[model samples]
Target chain A: MPSDALPDDPLPSWHDGRTKRAILDFIARVTKQGGPDYAPPAERIAVFDNDGTLWAEKPVYFQAQFALDEIARKAKENPALARQEPYRSVLAKDLKALTADNHKGLLQTLAVTHANMTTEEFASRVQDWLKTARHPVTKRPYTEMVYQPQLELLALLGKTGFRTFIVSGGGVEFMRVFADKVYGVPPERVVGSSDVVTFRMGKDGKPELYKTAKVEFVDDGPGKPVGINRFIGRRPILAFGNSDGDLQMLQYVTGGAGPRLGLLVHHTDGAREWAYDRKSPVGKLDKALDEAGARGWTVVDMKQDWKEVFPPAP
Target chain B: MPSDALPDDPLPSWHDGRTKRAILDFIARVTKQGGPDYAPPAERIAVFDNDGTLWAEKPVYFQAQFALDEIARKAKENPALARQEPYRSVLAKDLKALTADNHKGLLQTLAVTHANMTTEEFASRVQDWLKTARHPVTKRPYTEMVYQPQLELLALLGKTGFRTFIVSGGGVEFMRVFADKVYGVPPERVVGSSDVVTFRMGKDGKPELYKTAKVEFVDDGPGKPVGINRFIGRRPILAFGNSDGDLQMLQYVTGGAGPRLGLLVHHTDGAREWAYDRKSPVGKLDKALDEAGARGWTVVDMKQDWKEVFPPAP
Candidate 1:
C-alpha cells in the first residue's frame, strides 16, 4: 500500500521544536482524508486572536495607537479641543491618566475619535492611517510588525483547507481595513468589538451606515465566544491567542466534540519583542497561561519556537 | 473571435419572460470575465429574503407558526399554562387576538418560546420541529414549501460565482438548523434577527451559549442593511425579496457602484398559492410593490413567470 506523501516544511521561520511539531501533526491529522481526525473543508475552521498573537502589541494595542493618532489629528485641527480632560491627557501622552478610572477616560476619547461618521468615511480614515502610521518603538509601519512564523502557519493551514478568521478585541471596522491586505483574512471573517451602526438614506439617496458613539459589543475575555457564535455560527476546531482575553475562546474551541487544538503565543523574547505577559496592562496572559498548562494547550515560546519574529525588514 | 459561450438555462421552473430574461442577463454580465460589468467571485454577492421570497409564507410567517406550535405543545404539557392571555389566544388559534395591539400577544408568545435555553437546545428543538412540522394549508413539510424557481435561481447564482446569503426576519438559529440541508447555504451565510446569547461554563466544564429574551438585532426594513454590513461587510450586487421587509436591502444592493439586480416575487397566483399584498397582515408587499415599478426592479408575476411554484411532489 502507498503511504501518504509528506509535504515540505511549510513553516521555515518556525524552529524544529515541540511547539512546531504539535501544530504540524494537528494540521496533518485534520487534513488527512478518510482519517479518524479528518475534518471536512467547511468544518476546518481556525480562529486567531490579533494584537499580541499575530502582531506585536507593545506599549499599547495598535488600535489604541490609532485612536490616539485620531485624537492628535483632531487636536491639531482645533487646539481648544485639546484642553478637554481626555484630550489633554491623550495629547500629553499620559497613559496613566487615560487608563485611570477603569479606562473611563480612554473610552471617552475613543467615542469622540471613532464615531459619528459614515462607515465608508471611517474605513477611508483607517486606510489613510495605515498608510502613514508607524510603531512608536520600532518606527516601522505597524502592518510590517506582524509575526512571520504565524504567517507561514496561516498559509499552511489555508493550504490544508482551514478557513482562518481573526477574532480580535480591536474595533471591527479598524481591523477590516488591514485584515485582508496584512493577514489574508477578509473583512467578513474579522469579528471584533463594535459600535452601533445606524442605516439611513444619504443625501444622494444611497444607503449609508453611520457609525455611532454607542458601544454595542466588546469582543474580549468571555465575549470572544459570543462574537464567534454570533458571526461564524459554528465552533472553530482550532484557536490561538496570546492573553487572558482569549481564555473563553480557547475553552470553547477545544471543548467542542472533535479533534481540536488550543495554542497560545507566549511573548518571551524581551530583546526581539516586549515580554511582559502576566503583568502587562495590554494583552495580559496570566489566567490563560495557567489554563493552557492544565488543558494541555500548545504554548509557543517566542524566543525558542520562532527563528524570526517580523518578516525580514522588507 | 469566438463569442463567450452561454451556459445552459439554470432556471427551468422559471418561464421564458421579462423577469426570467432580466435575471439571466444580470447573471451573464456579472460572470463574463473582462466584460465591463464583470465582478470577481469574491465580490459577486447575492442576498435573498427568506420568508416570502425563497419559500411560501401565506397563513403566517413559518417562524410564527413554529412559535405557535411550541405554545400549543407547552400548553399540552401543562394545561394550566394555556389559561394565560397570550397562551389562551394562541391555544385557541386566534391569530386576530394574538396579532392585535401591535402583536403584543404574539411578541409575548415568541419571547417565551424562543428564549431561555442553550443554543444547542434551541437548535435541537428547531430540528425536531422541522422533522414533524407541516404547512397549515399545503400539508407538506414546511421545508418542502420553498419555491422551486427560487431554489433554481439560488443554484444558478452559486454556479455563476455569486456567494448567496439569506437575510431574513426569522430567528437566525431557527433558519440555521436547516439552512444547509434545505438552501445549500452554510450556517454562517444565514443572517437574520437574533436575540442576545450569553456565554458561560456549563455543568460539564464546557462552554455553552444561553439564549436570552433580550432582542439583539432585527434584520428587517432598515435593519437589513445594518445586518448586511455586520455579517457580509460588502454590498451585494443582486437582492431578491417579495415584500416591504426587504425594501431597504433592495435599495442598498441596487444602489451599489456597479451592475445590479433587484427582483421581487409577486404572489399573484390565487389558486396555486395565497395572494395578498397591500392589506395583508403578513408579508405585506405594499410599499415595495409600488417602488418596484419606479425602480425598474424585476417583478415576477407568480402566475405567469413560474411554470411551477413548489418542487414536484417528492
Candidate 2:
C-alpha cells in the first residue's frame, strides 16, 4: 500500500474529535504527493515531546523517578552515605526539605545518579530500571503507562513516512533505552537534555565514553529549536507536546513555510490519569496553552479526545 | 531481495585487493543471519569522515577554501571591507600573511563567513556556493570531486542494511549541504564541528535559530568519539576516515564489543589526487596511519584500492 493511504482505523484509541480530525487531515495533506501541501518523505518529520505528551508524567517525570531510585539504591549500598543532605532528606521522605533552596538537594541527587559512569554502564542501568520500575500512581511499569492513542499516532505517522522523533526534556540516554521498543523511534532520533561525556581508553583497553557531571545541552523551552537544528538538522512540520517547555518546539515546527501542525495534549482526565496543568509544578501548561488557542493549534482535551488512555496490561 | 545479498560487483570502482576484500568480508559477516557476527539492521551502523575520505581535501581543506571564498565574496559585496586585516590578505591572495599569527586571520575569515546568519540563510548560501565553487587544482565543481569508489562503498553499505553517516571535522551545516546529494547520507546523519545557535522569534514572527560566533563543539580527534556518541548514539560497526582527526573515532568504533572494521583511506595517488600525508598541512595522516598499521585496520592505498577517483564530469 502507498504510504499516503491510511490503514483502517489507524488511531482507534483516539475518539472522533476536532483535534483528531486536525491531525488526520494534516497527515493526509502532507502525504498526498502533487497536492499543494505535499511534503516529501524526507520533509515529513514529526517531533513529539516525551514525558506528559506520550506517557504519564504525573507525580514526577519517569526519569526523575529513576534518578531518585538510583539514589536510594546507592544509599542502600552505602548506609553512611544516606546520612548526607540529599540522601538523608530522601531517606526521611522529606520531599519539601529535599527540594528547598532552589532544588539544590534534588540537583545533587540527579548529579550523583546521572553521571560518573561509562555510557555503556549508564545504558545498562537505564535498561535494568525500566525492566522493573513501576509508576507511582498507576502501579504499571513506566513504559506500560504510555498513552495508547499516542502510540497509535506514532505508528500512523511512521506508516505515512513521517520520521517521528522524541524531542524531550528527559535525559537522552534514559529515553533511548526504551524509545525503540515503546515508540518505534531509534536512539539517534531521540533528542533530549544531555550531560557532557569524555572519551578515554578504558582499563580494558577499549574506548569508553564517561558521562561527566556538567550539563552539555538541555532540550527544553528555547533550547528545543536549538536542539532540533543541531541534531535533526530539519524543521519538523508537526510537533506535539503537553507543556510550556515544548512551546518553542511547537512554534519552531509550525513557523516554517508550508502546511504544519502544532498540537498540545492537555491532560484533562483526572480519573483516568493525572489532569493537573498550568498550576501543576510538573508539566505546567500555561503560556503554551494560551498560545495554542491564539494560534489555532490543536489542544487535545485528554478525556474528550481519547477513548482510551493506557493500553490493557500485557 | 534480502539485504544480506550483494549485487554483482557492488563496489564496482573498488579494485580487488586487501582493503576491498576486508570491507566485503566485514559486511558479509555482519549481515549473514544466524552467524555469530551478524548484527541486526539497527546495529549495522557505518560512519565515514568527509574531507579526505569521501572527497579531495587539497590544495586545502575544502571547508577552509569555502571560508576563504566566502570572505572574498563578502569583500566584493562591500569593497570598504577589503581594507580589513583578513579581507586585505584574502583580496591580495596572500594566504601566508593571513595565517601568520596562529591562524588568527584565517579563524576570523571562518568566523565572519560561517556565523551570525540564520540557519536557513546559511544553508542557502552554502547551496549557492557548492553550485559554483571549483577546486583550485582540478577546477571541477566541489561536489563532483567526491570519490567514486567511496560512493560505491556507501551504496553497498546501505544495500547491506547499514545506516551510513558522515562524521567529519568539517562544519556540520557545510557538510550537510552536499552530504545527501553527494554521499547519500541525510542531513541529520552528518555529525561535525558546529557553532552554537540561539533560538528566538524573528521580527517576521517566525522562529529562527541564529548561528553564533562561538564554537559549540569540534568533531576532531577526541571530539570525534564524543560527536559519534552524541549524534549517532550507537557504536558504529564500521568506520572509515583519511586523517588523524578520525583516529579516536576509528578507535571508538573498533573498540566496541562486537565484530567491527576500522578502515583508513591513505592518499597514495599523487598522480590522480594530491598525496601528502604525515607531514601535510591539511588532513595530516601521521598518528592515525601508525595506529591503523598497529591495529591491523584496513588501510586503503588510494592508487591501488580504487580503479577510479572522481566521477565523470556532468
Shift of residue A245 alpha carbon in model 2, Å: 0.7
Looking at model 1 chain A, report the run of 10 residues with the lowest lDDT sum: A1-10
Worst 10 residues of 2 chain B by lDDT: B1-10
Candidate 1 residue lDDT tens string, A145-204: 999999988887877788999999989988888888898888778999999999889998
Per-residue lDDT of model 2, residues A135-210, tens digit only: 8777889999999999999999988888998999999888888999999999899999999999999998888999
The interface root-mean-square deviation of each model, in the order shown, is: 0.9, 0.7
Candidate 2 residue pairs that clash:
none
Q: Per-model C-alpha lDDT, please?
A: 0.89, 0.89
- Every model's TM-score: 0.95, 0.97
- Quote the true-contact fraction of every model: 0.70, 0.78
List runs of model 1 lying over 4 Å from the truth: A1-7, A95-104, B1-7, B84-86, B94-104
Clashes of each: 0, 0
Top-TM-score structure, candidate number = 2
